[model samples]
Target: MDNMFRLMGSEEFSDRRRCIWVNGPVIIGAGPSGLATAACLHEQGVPFVVLERADCIASLWQRRTYDRIKLHLPKNVCQLPKMPFPENYPEYPTKRQFIDYLESYANRFDISPQFNECVQSARYDEVSGLWRIKTTTTSSIAGSEMEYICRWLVVATGENAERVVPEIDGLTTKFEGEVIHSCEYKSGEKYRGKSVLVVGCGNSGMEVSLDLANHNANPSMVVRSSVHVLPREIFGKATFEISMMLMKWLPLWLVDKLLLILAWLILGNLTKYGVKRPNMGPMELKVVTGKTPVLDIGAIEKIKSGDVDVVPGIKRFYRNHVEFVDGQRLNLDAVVLATGYRSNVPSWLQENDLFSKNGFPKSAFPNAWKGKSGLYAAGFTRKGLAGASADAVDIAQDIGNVWREDSKIHKMRSRVVYRRCISLA
Candidate 1:
């Protein structure tokens, strides 16, 4: 079943100095937490190997999102563990039906992921305890290089892996138009009537300014500070299922004062449509700053029906307008930015104390999936796909208890090398 997601032939991986030793667990990023850690290490029979840099398998929901994204959480809290999304999908599943339910949950667990192969460097040998990695494969023919040597690595490259772009002091030579970065946006069909802007109010700058105001463009957004928008439904269910039933029967400051009085009696006073509200509470700023509460899927009724338009942050960028910091300006022809994404995991971890100068993982939510030495990480727990299916069932039961104590020390070192080859016969 693992013809490594089929389509092999380049004389099959075209041996670039063949060195595929797997033992078990290598994972990197076939997305959706590396196919939920390859369906929990193929249900613990183990022998893993995912890799994917993206030729398929949920390449950030197949090709970096937006064409009207979706799954702003639902589909029963974004399933994965026993693979669920289909039963007539749509509690909010769009990015191409969540990339066709992640290619049918990687062919219902046959899970072959090599894909475009990227990893480019892993390192962690310390006298061969094992984890070398080093990938790179233009999918064979004129480009190839591989090397694995596993025994447990798992990263799952989750935190978007780069795309924050915000240093705006005239974003590199006064915007003359078309800047883009909501991961290279998608529809707004060549920005129809054109005007764009979008910057960042999170949730991909309020769903790409309500998809450039339902594709007639003119958009706007920006906001830049104070957020927490949430509202993909309120009494009719799913405001993240009533904030997970008030965070499972109230407490964290009474589930942030009852979801801030049910988001001020259902999203009213969005600072009278200039949108400000951020004195914390959106489940306490997603529990003290993981920050991600902009779920209002209709983009606040297209920013209160002015067909988007909010502005407030960027104070520079001229050659045709963009000075805001509330001093006001305008003229924009295109901007996008939707400003978000980080975690490149210090570009292949040269072990800077297992991260956290903001590069994340210093062990927090559900123990950031165990990362010290043998390293683990899976989906960086921003709680997407229920925290990457509970960090792929606790990293497949901690790599099936280190593959059963390394198979009982390789059967007691093969019975002490058969009693030293029967005392050298």
Candidate 2:
């Protein structure tokens, strides 16, 4: 660490900022994606510096996610590039288990990210042919401004860097209830027997409603638009695993039809309960738009048993109640916006060509990993952890090739310099 970070003279910088030189790429975020990329780089004998805004690794999982969250996909699919989940872990590891695994992965790869170092801005320096990353550290030794110069920059912050809470009419002003995003939600224990409104019908919304119902809270879920809710498993097989396998042999349209049929057989008609299906199939929709379908575990049963009310979009909120768009009104004690999260790339990174305004790779999947001027993205793939692992492998290999060639040239130059010195003597 000392060798990598030496304070530069004041004249070298416009603001007298401390500068650290990274031998290879500077990976932003210590989340699973970043760890995976670092691991792959290590395997390729590449040195890297990881920068994290939070105090711990995978801050989204460590702090933001609800307590009840689990790996939506199977453990095999969710595992990082080199390490697999422990044998004792279940098919769907809980949030805590996942965090433990990520920590272990980092240790295995000797990846020690500089935590609490929030990136203020990162831009490519055309003159230096490098990246200039400015950051502010916020630890016990806080308030230190630092700039990282690197040959490459890896944006491993992933897709869900920040939470999204939609603006609703009279929600903040008139509604005299506790309002919180799903990221802040931990559990449903405190709201037992209280009326709760859950906005958004995605996986988080469904699971939260189920949790509230289990805790004896009267949870009314707001399902405003069409959604695809598929059974998590079919006939003792994981639906996601099945989709991945079938995708190899069948057309996407056919796979969608088969999966929907299986889902219908297992879940039955959900229309009666106010959940409408989208015209686009689940997989197709996920590919076209980055919308993932809800993989039902227990929420469907709760919604069916009338324990959880399915309401329409909220029209407006009163002092202690909410009016639905369908002209119905219901009382509530709290509101949980399971409205999900979004990428925060555009806010920090200054590159305009690689990432779109929405903070995703402008290029579509299978081609989104690499960008211009030594910029790479990991975990932006809507395909989830598996996609991230793929990105990690490819990134390491690409960087590794260039690094090896540079090393060879440096060695040759060093040998020439040594011979010249000997001859001069």
Candidate 3:
């Protein structure tokens, strides 16, 4: 790889257009997806820069997630491209354990990312056939703007960039109790004897409610619509592992039928507890609508044992009480909006082709990673870490091939970029 700017020393310049040129791709996140891509690229002898908005790698895991959250999937599927989890780790690693694994993986690969540099905007320069990325640093050298010009822009930011907070009627004005998103919530110790309203019945919501119930808090989970709740394990093996095994032999529909049959036999009918299954099978629903099924991990048992209440959607909030869609009203002390997350691509990425208005790639998984003008995505796949790892490997291989071809004739005496652009690690 060639360096466009030879002046590695800090310098000031008024010309903003003349930026530091990255000989390889400029990855957007320092999360698992981004780290995996960087490691794979390193193996291919490619030099790249990773820019993270946060101070540390895996900010979501380190700063945002609750303390009790573990890897929903098995460690085998959650591992990155090149590094495998430690043999001593549990089947489902804890949050801290997963973060530790990512740290070790980064250390093993010597992947140093430019931390606290948040990308403000990234646009493809049609004239230069390169991507121009503008960012602002939040570190001690704060409020300073920096730009990077690179041939490739790998968007490894992943699916959950921003937390989704729904605008419910009277949510802000009428509610007298404390309301916080799931990302902001860590534990239920403070809410020990209080009634907590948990919104959105996704995996996070279910898990959060379970945590609250375990902590001796009254948590009423709201099931707004139909959802698929599957057992985390079928018999003794992991349900996901069984699904993968069956997928290799049987058709998706057939596998779904078998899995549902097993789920029914094990968990019984969920309708009795106010839980409704979606019309589409779990896998089919996930593939068609990107809605993941809830893998039961003691939450359903809590609901069945009357430790956690399963309620309907919220109509509005009235003082310290919530009115459900089914005309049931209950007084609650706090509300935890486990509404999940969305991609921030549409907010900063100044492009229209590769990503849709909703910040997801227009194309589906597998094909969603690569796009025109060297734009790529890593973790947008609804299939979770396993899918993201697949995308990371594919991206590295593609960029490595081009880098190999370019190195054959790349010369040292190349034009240097202007002083305005900073060369980050």
Instruction: Give one clash count per candidate, in the order shown.
Output: 0, 0, 0
The C-alpha lDDT values of all candidates are 0.79, 0.92, 0.90
Best by TM-score: 2
lDDT of 1 by residue, 218-299 (tens): 9888886788776778888888788777787777778777776787788777887778777767776787777878878688
Tell me how many residue pairs clash in candidate 3.
0
Top-scoring candidate (lDDT) = 2
Clashing pairs in 1: none
What lDDT tens digits, residue by residue, belong to model 3 across residues 1-425? 22334223225324645466687899999999899999999999999999999999999999999999999888998899888999999999999899999999999999999999999999986655778898988896446778988889999888899999999988999999999999999999999999999998999999999999999999999998899999999888899999889989998899889989999998999999989988789888887989888999999999999999999888999988999988989998999999999899998999888899999999997899999999999988888889989998999999999988777645322323322233531
- In angstroms, how far off is 287's CA in candidate 2? 1.1
Question: Once model 3 is optimally superposed onto the true structure by TM-score, how far is the C-alpha of residue 38 displaced, in angstroms?
Answer: 0.5
CA RMSD of all predictions: 16.8, 2.6, 5.9
Q: Tell me the TM-score of model 3.
A: 0.93
Query: For model 2, how does the per-residue alpha-carbon lDDT over 321-399 read when each residue is reduced to its tens digit?
Result: 9999989899889999999889999999999988999999999878899998999999898989999999999999999
lDDT head-to-head 1 vs 2, winner: 2
Error of 1 at 373 (Å): 24
Error of 3 at 288 (Å): 1.0
Q: How does model 1 fare in lDDT? A: 0.79
Q: Model 1, stretches more than 4 Å misplaced?
A: 1-16, 22-24, 29-143, 147-155, 159-176, 182-196, 203-219, 222-248, 251-257, 262-268, 274-292, 295-330, 339-377, 380-393, 400-402
